[model samples]
Target chain A: MKKYLMKGNEAIAEAAIQAGCRFYFGYPITPSTEIIEYMARKMQQVGGTFLQAESEIAAIYMVFGASGSGKRVMTASSSTGISLKQEGLSFLAANELPAVIVNIMRTGPGLGGLGATQADYFQATKGGGHGDYRLIVLAPNSVQEMTDLIMDGFDLADIYRNPVMILADGILGQMMEPVIFKEPEKIEIDKSWATTGANGRKRNIITSYNLHNEAGEEKALYLEQKYKGIKEQEQRWEEYHMEDAEYVFVAYGTSARIVKGAVDQLRKEGNKVGLIRPITLWPFPEKAFIPLLNRIKGYMVVEMSAGQMVEDVKLNVNGAAPVAFYSRQGGITPQPEEIIEKFNNSYHKGGEQ
Target chain B: MGETIFSKTKGLTNTPFHYCPGCTHGIIHRILAEVLEELAILQDTIGVAPVGCAGFIEKYINVDFQGGAHGRAPAVATGIKRALPDKVVFTYQGDGDMASIGTAEAIHAAARGEKFTTIFVNNGIYGMTGGQMAPTSLIGQKTSTSPYGRDSSQSGYPLDFPLLISQIPGAAYVASVSVDTPQNVIKAKKAIKKAFEIQMKGIGFTMVSVLSTCPTNWGMSPIQSIKWLQENMKNYYKLGELKTPEMLNQ
Candidate 1:
């Protein structure tokens, strides 16, 4: 393993290259453009292709084409840019194409701001675009996790033939941290499903259009089963100081980082506060909170959005304990001290059940 | 038994085309299939099919195909060709799909000089969507959308895509041909073959814009559609090569 102090976006790009990703298609968007820039500088040297597409719409389709051809491919965009990619993302999901998409999320409903935000939790976890589809969403709190999750993201994408999203935010994307990259794993994937020229086999066609009712139903059922399998097998999370805690904080990505700080400070003050950070935002790791529901008095959901993920936490808790939410929206992030205050107020007042 | 004089190209599948009667997309598909067969690259070619009537080309073509969203085939072809440079990559796009919603993708692909072939079918109307007015629809032409005829004051003039593509510095070959006649069909095949050959040579972006008849959309008989294309489209989209590698060398 080699250790280097790298920016979060740069580390993700390098990890993708190390993971055998050979094609990158992107259009410049703030907070995530560094990943594209890094790929442009390094992909060519590694005998890969990095293309700056005309638009985010075009970039994602390029990824669709490359991934359909059995090459590991990726793309990066910020909030509005990612929103622009939803159409192609839907197509990618329907085609069952494996691709890595990094959304270094910024605040948005529409061109909101360039600062960090977790507003896209709903968009990422739920189907962002048209149709009944889901992306395997991975949230990384640190630059190191950014590298690790991206490598895992590609593996999981290929294994399930689904799009995997590394859902970070501007903070994690811009922050510099020491990252250790292990030797690239050599992966041999079966090309039988790929559309890489017919040569000695039946012609391979990749498309999302299912005109017949029965065919569409079968496809949807197959995808539903696959998603269920993923939920059963791949839900990931990290528990910090949760063994004997009364109040637990649920967060992911940059909010998790800040929540950890708050938890540490509250523990030093003799408060029984802990954190449950979700790594896989899609499968949600609800099981992590299920067993702890009886032990914990309440769950404090901290986010960079308007309490989007709190709903999920509430569902997981399921009346076993109250779930309270505190959020800072439009690119403003709450500090550790602010979170502590919010927790104290909520914990003392009894969270909403 | 006597030797057969003619047979279908092996590059095409047994699946019958879904194109409407009198539509020219089948002719264009046949020409492309013949070219791929003649070059013996059917086993190594990957085609990008655009959304529209020709979106189902993958079903009829024997080579591997990636279906692209409406107007995004050029970008899709760029990705495929860039990822697998050893494979022959091409895109089959309609005029509405290419010149209208996909204008930026087409222009940028040509400007980047991505090594691929594009077979652009300009039928002057949207065939699959019930004869909507296309970006290539002629002035004063009437369609489902332009019920009172295409007024230049409202929708503007038709787009000359080959002329636009040829102007890009990255494009190595650009041609405008038609399938309106047997001789023109031969010339169109030659142009398609040249575009594929240039892609094989890695000579940068190449495109062949074939002026085709949309009898169903144009509200004309199959014979009248051909004659109308011969007279009207010929006046706007001039036939023959617009740019070639030799021109770039000069």
Candidate 2:
């Protein structure tokens, strides 16, 4: 396998092409602008379409149009730009259209500065749009995972007939690393429900609107069942140093890397600390926590936001294990020493609580 | 079987339209359906349906349709056209949908010269939502929201949307027509057919703005509304083929 040194954003673009995504609709925005720029130059060569929409709002609607046409489509944006896409995202999910969306993190809540921040954890996992829906969120910490997860993201989108999101921060987006491009696996799914010209058949109409209230409620129940199946089947995570560990740090994305560094240092002091890093942030690694809930003394969630993922941690833990949270807000990324110091203070060093 | 000289277009579905008694949306829908049948493009066509009264157009058209958000049909049509260049695509949008809420999507799609057609039904007031003021509502026109007659200072003047669309360099063909009289209906059909034909040629963006009436929303009887539109709407909106590819090149 040839190794290509590339940034996470570039890897996402190339990986999507390899995954057979022929349509990309996006607007230029920070931390992920390279994804669209790369597509603009490379798409026509691959026999695909690339359009820089007038606004993020237009780009996502463009995603709606292409996806409805039975093609694999994608769009990428950062914090606020993703916010502009929420309305279209709701329409896509309600209509059950398959598309991939990537949100590279930036400090936000009205033009927060350009350093990396995991502040959008709640917005990404929870439906940011005005509907009861969930985006299949994939969090990639490194450039290689960015390539792997984006390829898998498109597959998951088609398999489930819903939008899948690649959720990462600026640290992973811009940072370069050597990545091996595996031969792309072709996953074929049925697209008979798609709105392609309805040529020799009954006209297919794609809409999220249900005229009657009962029909809307019935559709909501159907979606709930699909989500239940996803939760049962798609919980993914990485367990590090689980054997004989007394305490664990629960984290993901950039925060997970910082927690790992803290875990390695704390183990040297015989602290018996481990890490549970979630790869899918929505159908969160609840299975990883359930088996250890009775045995582990406490779980501390480290995030770059002010306690967003910690809510999920507490919900999953459900009082079996004491859950604590430490975070840095507004683009401040904490170092491993900070996590270690906070852990020692929170658990009193020996899981005695 | 007796020989038939006239028949309904196969381009329309069996589903009956639910438009109000005096609404001109049915006329526009009929002419649009006729254009598709005449061009032999019904089987290879896709439509983007706008919100408001026309939002339900997906049910009535025989071709495939995608329903857009409040005013995003043009953006949606751009996506469909770009993805399937061999297929003919168009958007049927209302005044409130295309002009008031979806102004950016319309202007930019035309500016980019996206290869598609737009049938903008300019009904002056918000029809589906029960008579609210629209960007196309004329000065001193009374609606439920603008009960005191649309004040120019408060509501701004009526927007001549076709004039704006025709000015865009990417727009290959643009026309503003009325459906009041029988002769004018014939002329409107010609413009509608020409707009779709331009799309088949893979020319730039094309649009035909049809001045429509809403009797229920205008608080008039069906006959009174037709007379009111002829006297009032025709006076304000210029009716003709405003721009053509020929004009653009010259």
TM-score to native of every candidate shown:
0.97, 0.98
Ten contiguous residues with the weakest lDDT in model 1 chain A: A344-353
- lDDT (Cα, tens digit) per residue for candidate 2, span A317-351: 89987887788878889899988888988898554
DockQ of all models, two decimals each: 0.79, 0.79
Candidate 2 per-residue lDDT over residues B1-250, each given as its tens digit:
9999998998888898999998899999999999999999888999999999988898887899898699999988888888889999999999999998999999999999999999999989998889999999999999988999999989889999999999999999999998988898899999999999999999899999999999998989988999999899889988798899998888
Positional deviation of residue B35's Cα in model 2 after best superposition, in angstroms: 1.2
Residue pairs in candidate 1 whose N, alpha carbon or C atoms collide under 3 angstroms = none
lDDT values for all models: 0.91, 0.90
Candidate 2 residue-wise lDDT at A311: 90
Candidate 1 lDDT over residue span A1-353, tens digit each? 66899999999999999898989999998989899999999998998988889999999999998998888999999989999999999999999999999999988888888988999999999989999999999999999988888899998999899999999999999989999997655666676888888889888989876569999899999999999999999999999998888989999988888899999999999999889999999999988987886688888899999888899998899998778788888889889998988888887766432
- For model 1, the superposed segments whose C-alpha errors exceed 4 Å read A184-188, A350-353
Residues B29-144 of candidate 1 have per-residue lDDT tens digits of: 99999999999999999999888888888888789989868899998898888878899999999998999999999999999999999999999998888999999999989999
